[model samples]
Target chain A: MKGVTVLQSGGSNQMELADLSVPESGQDDLLIKVHSAAVNRTDIMTREGKAGYAVNPILGVEVAGTVVEAAGSGSFSAGDRVMGLVNGGGYAEYAVMPANRAMKIPDSISSAEAAAIPEVFLTAYQTLFWIGKLQKQEAVLIHAGASGVGTAAIQLAKQLSDAKVIVTAGSRRKLDFCRELGADILINYKEQSFDEEVLKATDGRGTDLILDFIGADYWDKNLASIKHEGRWVLIGVLGGSELSKVNLMPIMSKYIQLTGTLLTPRSDSYKAELSKDFAEVVTPYLEQGKIRPVVDSTFPVEKVHEAHQHMEDNQNIGKIILNIASAEA
Target chain B: MKGVTVLQSGGSNQMELADLSVPESGQDDLLIKVHSAAVNRTDIMTREGKAGYAVNPILGVEVAGTVVEAAGSGSFSAGDRVMGLVNGGGYAEYAVMPANRAMKIPDSISSAEAAAIPEVFLTAYQTLFWIGKLQKQEAVLIHAGASGVGTAAIQLAKQLSDAKVIVTAGSRRKLDFCRELGADILINYKEQSFDEEVLKATDGRGTDLILDFIGADYWDKNLASIKHEGRWVLIGVLGGSELSKVNLMPIMSKYIQLTGTLLTPRSDSYKAELSKDFAEVVTPYLEQGKIRPVVDSTFPVEKVHEAHQHMEDNQNIGKIILNIASAEA
Candidate 1:
């Protein structure tokens, strides 16, 4: 099997394609013939030897594939279209996925689209509903609105909870894209003070929940934009991670619940449970086309570097997928 | 009726007793003949005109007394002993308490003891179980170990969930009191590095939940003391509120859930609900004398200023109570 490996040399790491043995599936796992895999910031971090939790030398964390060997249980069968989080061999021709974490790809969705769903959508779902506890009709401010997780959160907040979705993006194009995907209020972060815009949009009360991708840079503004007793879920720290002389009095006065999370480092059981819940609630939406994974672009497995570069350059609106099936064939 | 009033003259405020009209009970409220009232940091803040939520000129928040006039709902009769959180006017001879917030005084508990319970116990309960979601046998770190809320939390964490309660206090006396209240580990904040002590006590993983009272001074220590995915409930900022050059990466990497809350600023409905839950879960323990409010000292209503001075000097452990029955008589 062909897999992407991180090669370290001269104090820097590079991603390279290498011939590797097929990973063995555990009793409760399925050996998958990976059709597609999505590029994520974590993958970039893993490739750069920064992700401590990435034990598998193989790149990628999510994939859409066919189950070549099913688990002992009758939950799935060989040749079944599956898409879910992998234990980090997703950028390979073959990978092993836990049976419990596997989500059957809906007939209406393509493998490439399914590959985009698991990591971002589940991350968004966990951050928005599981951690944030977003209530019906509540307002949610999603930063980096056009990013994969952000886009998923916007859609999920609108679709599942009927929440008023407010978004902040760096460009007009991203903000427009967010608006088309059910963002009620859009703030061009580069051009506008988002906190002021959010305050204006919500009659000065501020949003009930915030999906903060930009951490330190937007910490104060995010604090100001959140309502009293609001929930702030920090899923990313793209802007920065260190805060200088941050006054936490406002957080106390407003009674904010701030949770910091990452999807990749979660325990296997936790992921399984989250995947199960996400599939139960969101699979119907996907099948009905009420919710869809936003695939920005696709690259062949040979062009995996370009896919990662696209994400690093922030040129993609949503997921950048790697087509692994052709390379495997 | 007589009540304590905040007299704002120049830059400072003074607490003085004055003749006032008896507070009337609403349809769902009980007019209580105040027997005792507990002094809290919020009450001190109110006296100094620092609390924005304190609308009534009178001081105090939690009280214990006989119901002079009961609510129409038949939940309590006239002459029934009750203790509860009042919106304001707790320092008055007669004060109105919403029926839902009222907790029946057990035969085993005195009015002074009951008075000590509402504010601190409820705050601890809210922070530990409600917001913190402390599970069975989980370890908890309670700062200001001999403080009212700290003592209450120590007992509740031990009694309710059998949690391993770690405490940090400034003095040996305070730490002793904490140990008596069922705290498993005691670290004298003045003598030892609390974070290092906490880490040692927990085998380097740190506590699952933290009840932080000292904010900025303990920020780094609290961050270091918390376990991965730990719940840090900030209920007070006694030390300071502003943090300088704080690294939030650890918070994200550890998946920390940080919540800032103040019971005084919460809504009437929220208080009622919290009171109801507290009464349901805790009333039996109180009745059985399994859980008790630690009352430090009681002062006559006329000596309200002295009580405030005592709290300001931090000379007392547990709760400071004001004996209002003598003045009323």
Candidate 2:
């Protein structure tokens, strides 16, 4: 089998297509014939040798493919169309996915679209509902509104909880995309003070929850944008991580609950549970076309570096895909 | 009626007993002939005119006494022994408590003991179960172990959840008191590296929950002492409020849920609900003498300034009470 491998002599964007053996399916695993894989910041981090938890030498973390071999007594069977998070090795001809974490791709969704759903949607679901506990009609402020997780969170917050979705993006195009996906308020963070805009939009009460992707740069603004007893879920630190002279007195005074999380580092059992819950609640929305995956563009497996670069440049509005195999074949 | 009032001529410990009209009970309130009032840091803040939420000029937050007038259609009746959080006039001969927030004084407890229970116990309850969401048999690290809320938390964690209670205090005597109150591990924070002791005690996984009272000073140590997915509830900022050059990456990497809260500033309805839930779960234990209030000592109402000074000097363990009227009478 051919897979994407990081070069030992490392620098930025050091990856090569190399031949490797097909992974053996474990007791509760399925061997998948990879159709398409999604590119994420985690993959970029893995390529840069920065992600400590990326134990699997392979580059990809999520895929949409066909199950070639299923585990004994597993729900999935051979030839079933599926999409789920892979332990790694997703940018290849074949990959192994845990049976419990696998979700059957709907007939209406294409392989490329299916590949985009698992990581971002599940992360958004976890942050908005599982961690943030966003209540019905509550307001949520999602930063990087056109990014994969940001886009998914905006839709999920609106669809599942009937929440008022407020989003911040750097450009008018990205903000428009977010607005099209049910965002009630859009702030071009480059031009305006997002915290002031959020306060004005919410009549000074502030949003009930904030999905913070920019950590240090937006800490004070995020704090200012959240309501009393609000929830703040930190999913990324795109701008930076270190904060200087932080006055945490506001957190106490506001009674804010702040949580930081990453989905890739979670245990297999936790992923399985999250996947199951995500599938149960969100699959119907996909099938009904009430919610859809936003695929910005797809790159052939050989152009993996470009796909990563595109994400790093913040040029994409949604998921960037690496086409591993032609589904028509 | 006589109440402790902060002097307008500003200075530390500037409080005087002054004649004041008896407060009239609201629609859902109980007018109580106060027997005892518990002294807290809030009282000291009030005396210094530092408490922004101290709407009433009187300087106390919790009281225990007999109800002299109950709401027209309330649960309590005249002559009923009650203890609860007061809006502001707790350190007075006559104070009014919200009927819904009032708890019946257990027959086994004295007025001073009952006065000690409401604020600390309720604050501990809010931090531990409400905000922290501590699970059964989980390990908890309580800072200021011999302080009012710390002692209450140690007892509650042991009695209610059968949790492994680890505590940190400044003195061996305080640690010993914590041990007597069911704390499993005690660290004299003055002489020992508390984070190292906590890690050693928990075999490096760290505690599941932390009741943090010393904020900025303990920030890093508390971060190091909590387990992945741990809950850190900030209920006080005694050490300091500003954190210099703080790194927030660990909060996300460890998936820590951090919340900050103050019981005094919470809305009336919230307090009523918290009081209701707390009384339902903890009243029986109080009645059985299984969980008793830890009142350090009582000062006559006329010596209210001394009580504030005692707390400021950190000379007392558990609660310091202001005796307003003799309970026997």
Candidate 3:
């Protein structure tokens, strides 16, 4: 298998395409012939030596592929097109996906689009619906609205429920893209304060749920923008991590719940459950053309460094995809 | 009717015994001839002009007494003994309690004990079980374990589930009292660091749930002592409210949930539901003599100032009760 592997000799370095043996599919796993993979900050951080490196460190965590082999007793069969969470081997020709995590990708979307859906879409779904407990007629404020998860959250939240969706983005273009994705209210955070806008928009009640990716920079504002008994789900810390000062009094007085969540380190069974839920809820929406994957750009697997650099520079508005298969294939 | 009232002419002054007319019971309320009242920090703060002032502000929030009058459609009848949460007027000889908030007191406990149970016990019950979502066999760390809510939480958590209860207290006496109440691990915070003790006691996994009142003082330590996906329930801010510098990365990495909760200011129906749950869960324990009220000291209603002074001084081990009537009554 040709895959993206990090060179362990260097302190901080680039990912390289190298030949590797195909992984054995576990009893409850599917051997996927990966068509495409998605570039995420985790991959960049791991490559940069910021996050801990894994043994035999392969880069991508999200993939769209077809099952080449299925373990006995698993639901998936050979030649079935699937996309979902992968255990670090996604930037490869072959990857092992837990049977529970893989869901059939509808024929309506392309393989690169399917690759973009797993990590970002599932993250948006789990954070908004499962952890944030967004309800109909309630309001949600999603930070980083132009990013992959942000775009996915806006679409999923808008289509799946009657909740009012408000979004904050850095640039006007991203805000515009979020607006196209059905965000009810938009805040160009570079222009104005989101907390004030949120308060003013909601008649001082603040949003019922908040999905924040920028941790310390937006921590106080997120707290201010949350309603009494509101939920602020933290999925990423792109802005920063050290919170200067957070007055916990409001959290108690207003009954606010600040939850920190991540999709990467969850159990395989949990991912499978989320996969089942994602298929049941969002699959039909995809099939009906109510939601579409927002692909920013695609690169051949050999250009994995460029994809990581693009995401690092915050140049991509949506998912940056890596086409694993060769043009001739 | 005679009641304890704060003199509002001056800024944050004193409590005084005042003569007042009995309040009329609402359609769904019970007019009770108060036998006992519980002195709480909220009452002290209100009297000190720290919280807020109400029209004819009374100093008590919990009471146990005999029903003098029942509204047109209430379960209570004249002469029925009841204990319940009250908005105000609990310090009065006659207090009005919502029928839903009031529950019949068992014959085993005294009126003072019943009065001590409402605010503190209900706060403990709601914080530990409802907001904290404590599960069986999980570990919980309770701060201020000698205070009213702490004592109640320890007792209730012990009787209801098989959860391990770890407690932190300021003094040796308080730690001893907590141990007597079935606290498995006791950290004398005055002598050693609670975070170190908690980490050691939990075997580095930390506690599953934390009921915290020492806000800013324990903010950082609380974050350090929480397990992955643990819940930190904040009910009070006795130490301070301003958190200096908190590293939110731990919260994100550990998936910690920090919730700010309060029993006061909740809707009547919400309180009623909590009241019903409290009664259903803990009432049997009280009846079976498995749990008993830990009353620190009882002050005569006229000496309400002294009780407030004692609580403000942080000298009491458990609930400070105000005896509204003598034994002859």
Best by lDDT: 2
Model 2 C-alpha lDDT per residue in residues B213-274, reported as the tens digit of each score: 99999999999999999999998999999999888789989999999999999999999999
Per-candidate TM equals 0.95, 0.98, 0.96
Candidate 3: what lDDT?
A: 0.86
| Tens digits of per-residue lDDT for model 1, B183-287 | 999998888999999999999999999999988999988989999999999988998888887887888989999999999989999999999999999999999
What are the candidates' C-alpha RMSDs? 2.2, 1.7, 2.1
Model 3 lDDT per residue over B1-329, tens place: 78878766332236678878878888888899899999888887677676653444776788999998887745778998999998888888888888988988999999988988899889998998899988988899999999999999998888787779999998888999999998999998889898888999989999999999989988878988989999999898888998778787778878889898888778889999999988988888899889888899998887777787888889899889888875224
* Per-prediction DockQ: 0.82, 0.87, 0.84
lDDT per residue (tens digit) for residues A188-298 in model 3: 998999999999989999999999999999877888899889999989988888877777777887899999988887877889899999999889999988988889999
Q: For model 1, how does the per-residue alpha-carbon lDDT over A229-328 read when each residue is reduced to its tens digit?
A: 8999988889888888788788889999999999999999999999999999999999999999999999998988778778888978999999998885
Per-prediction tally of clashes: 1, 0, 2
Question: TM-score rank, highest first?
Answer: 2, 3, 1
lDDT of each: 0.91, 0.91, 0.86
| Best candidate (score: TM-score) | 2
Model 2, range A201-302, lDDT digits (tens) per residue? 999999999999889999999999999999999989998999987997899999999999989999999999999999999999999999999999999988
Q: Give the worst 10-residue stretch by lDDT in candidate 3 chain A.
A: A7-16
**Model 2 misplacement above 4 A:** A326-329, B326-329
